[model samples]
Target: GYRTLRENDTGLNGALEIPAMRRLLPDLRGKAVLDLGCGFGDFARYARAQGAEQVIALDVSANMIDAARALTDDPAITYRHASIEDCTTAPAAFDLTVSSLALHYIADYPAVVQRVFDSLKPGGTFVFSVEHPVQTAHPVGWVRDADGNRLHWPLDHYQQQGARSTSWFVDGMIKYHRTMETYVNTLLDRGFQLRHLAEPCPPAEVLQARPDLEDTVRRPPMLILVATKPAKRK
Candidate 1:
């Protein structure tokens, strides 16, 4: 079963993530797009509205796919039930592939990145967001004082990367933890040209909207990666 966690939140995903991605994203006019881990197809709908020629949105959960399909009525957008690890596409089929906060859940990142690289056209772009290494470096919370006052976040086992369990909308959610080097070098090794990276802090407007989120500015929760596939040689 899938749960909708962030849709109700107005702080990070709505303000920081979407705005950061839009800043780096090239024009979407008349392009074939792929939305990996397309939960409820929000980005897919946005791409279609932005004039994408076609959009293929895929998710590992059937409930998510069903929700996306029911909410989306456009002929240009197709939602499929598939995992990022197992999903395949025609070579050089997409002009852009965008994912939002989903990669950390996948354990086989290298293989999946290779798949994404293979699925894109020459010079195509892949923009994605994931949990930041600092946040994922350890699953433990901040060490507070005797009064339970705030304290600093802890970093442990950073060099050791593997499964990290946490409770979100549901209990016992599992996600993979990889170092920043692993993330960047893996893409480079797979032939992706890293263009931009972001560890976004909530902006002033977002802070004003939700003052409690001020700490998110100091502690970056998410990381954004923008990479491109090189054009074929002549």
Candidate 2:
């Protein structure tokens, strides 16, 4: 729904989403997992294939929920139409929570982060990815040199006259970006331990095949964040 499954329903986006989840959560077997922004439930399907005991895919789009229900008959998989900020109806129900290529669209990201923290069982894990702030720092349109060589842009290239303006190409969709520090701080405040934070650097083979956007690809286009809910101690 609001997760932009339509904008990124292509094979390439699918290719990117699957591997990213595998990297973030290495051992998901027999775990109760929640897939937020579960566009078409692709990642949920992948988690089941990886041997997750149960998986619930939630999105804000009803069309996506209905379409996902029709696509597969796997009894262990369930799909729901709900926003991340409203996902705490059952607190601490999941052992793992994941949202891929999502969260950037949320204007109130701290609330979303808090909901995710509240949804996980103690000792549970949470992993998610979103467009890197660096991507936002770069200008929307890059310039090419006469020799067709691209010049590297400045760190604040996208900042115009000390005011940052957001650009949306399709139908004025909303996007909210937080700095790296802001992201980390939110997790800490929610009692989540930051375990791993990375920008996916696809395998060299994938890059070699598509060299058109080498410059942009070299930098972090998407940032992966991993955190955990601590186990209860008596």
Q: Cα RMSD to native, each candidate?
A: 1.8, 3.5
Highest-lDDT candidate: 1
Could you tell me how far off, in angstroms, the CA of residue 139 lies in candidate 1 after the best superposition? 1.8
TM-score of each: 0.93, 0.84
What would the TM-score be for candidate 2 when compared with the true structure? 0.84
Q: lDDT of candidate 1 vs native?
A: 0.88
The backbone clash count of each candidate, in order, is 0, 0
- Worst lDDT 10-window in candidate 1: 1-10
For model 2, state the Cα shift of residue 91 in Å: 1.2
The runs of at least 3 residues in candidate 2 whose Cα sits more than 4 Å from the true structure, single-residue gaps closed, are 1-17, 146-149, 157-170
The alpha-carbon deviation from the true structure for residue 54 of candidate 1, after best TM-score superposition, in angstroms, is 0.5
User: Which 10 consecutive residues of model 2 have the lowest summed lDDT?
Assistant: 157-166
Candidate 1: list runs displaced more than 4 Å. Answer: 1-4, 146-148, 169-172
- Which tens-of-lDDT digit does each residue in 31-138 have in candidate 1? 999999998898999998889999999998888899888898899998989989889899999999999989999989999899999999999999999989988989
Write the residue-wise lDDT of candidate 2 on 104-147 in tens digits.
77777888878887888999998998877776554364556889
